[model samples]
Target: MAETPIFPAIGAPAPDFDMPASKGRQVSLAAMRGKPFILYFYPKASTPGCTTEACDFQEALGALGSTGLPVIGVSRDSMKAIDTFATRQNLDFPLASDATGAVTEAYGVWVEKTLYGRKYMGIERATFLIDADGRVAQVWRNVKVPGHVAEVMRAASAL
Candidate 1:
């Protein structure tokens, strides 16, 4: 049996992590203190759903940033793959690589998934809204791509 990872709850400090991201830099929750940010976990890069979600976020970047929130996408893909995805999608936000899955585990987005009777461990689409104090303000699990970015933008705007 797999132990269930403990996800951070609302009003609790978010689990901190540092991972390699595109543009040849490391992104960390610690560095984002004093600013609200969005941390969204997706299963893979360049896939249809993921692409749509990413592009939606990209399109709303201006609006989302108007609330002074930075957005980040997390995946277990390699840094090279993340770079390509960012470039191909013209993504302006950082997409961090969690090849070791540690960050995903900490965020509690990594879990066992069954698709067509085949079971595997992978990222479950989830999003976390962290407040300027570094505490989680909101969370969405098993996210659907459509209208999701707009919803997040609304939530971030209210923060």
Candidate 2:
């Protein structure tokens, strides 16, 4: 298991990362520093909740982008999985595969979870909002997909 940081504290610098993107490009958090960013970490690519979240963001792409806040989805799945998920769903934003769990750990979302009373390690679905000055604007951990992007937007709009 990777070493995950404690839950990212709001008002701090968001932990930095550079992971493999679905488009074969490795994106660094630094590259997105000048604009608000939505960095969401999910369990895996193409899974039910993950897909719903991705699609929700996809459907809200225009609205979100119009606000100048880009969304980036992260997961432990491979780039192939991300590619298939994006093509199949026609997702407009980038999806990064955190196959090594480095980014997950950095954000503290790779955690122990319980399902049917069986505890195991998995991602705790979460989202981070980084503001233009590279500060951690907000952190949403243990998130549910429904209405998440809207919540992020609501928060970002106030930033």
Candidate 3:
């Protein structure tokens, strides 16, 4: 049996990441310091659940931004795929490509999953709220789409 992955605990330093993102950009933990931000991991881009989540975030972008928090979505998809998804979804926030899986693994979002009796390795639907000091403020694992963005928004505003 595979060992369960351990995630970064609240108040622990968030794992550093530098990834290629949509709109021809690079988003790094170093650059995100001094401000709280949302880093969410999804299994794939443009899928049903992922789309719902992304669109929800997009709709809440204004409120989130008002709190001085930026939202970043991460997936193991290629840059081309992520870029296309972002464009199609009209997402203003960055959709980062973690093709190498390093960032996902580091965040403990990469895990073994079973679907229809088939087992595979995939990225878990997870979110991390990192504070200005780079410490993890909150974490949501195996996230469900409904009302999730609002929940995150509330937490971010409280930060």
Computed on alpha carbons, the lDDT of every model, listed in order, comes to 0.93, 0.86, 0.95
Best candidate, TM-score-wise?
A: 3
lDDT of 2 by residue, 34-70 (tens): 8988888888887898899999999888888788988
> Higher-TM-score candidate among 2 and 3?
3
| Model 1, span 1-159: residue lDDT tens | 467878899999999899999879789988999999999999999999999999999999998878898999999999999999999999999999998888899999999898999888899999999999999999999999899998998899889
Q: Model 1 scores what on Cα lDDT? A: 0.93
Summarize candidate 3's per-residue lDDT along 41-129 as a digit string, tens digits: 99899899999999999999999989999999999999999999999999999999998889999999999999999998999999999
Candidate 3 error regions (>4 Å):
none
Candidate 3, residue 24: Cα displacement in angstroms equals 0.3
Off by over 4 Å in 2: 1-5
lDDT of candidate 3 at residue 157, scale 0 to 100: 89
Report the lDDT of model 2 for residue 121: 88
TM-score of each: 0.97, 0.93, 0.99
Q: Worst ten-residue run, lDDT, model 2?
A: 1-10
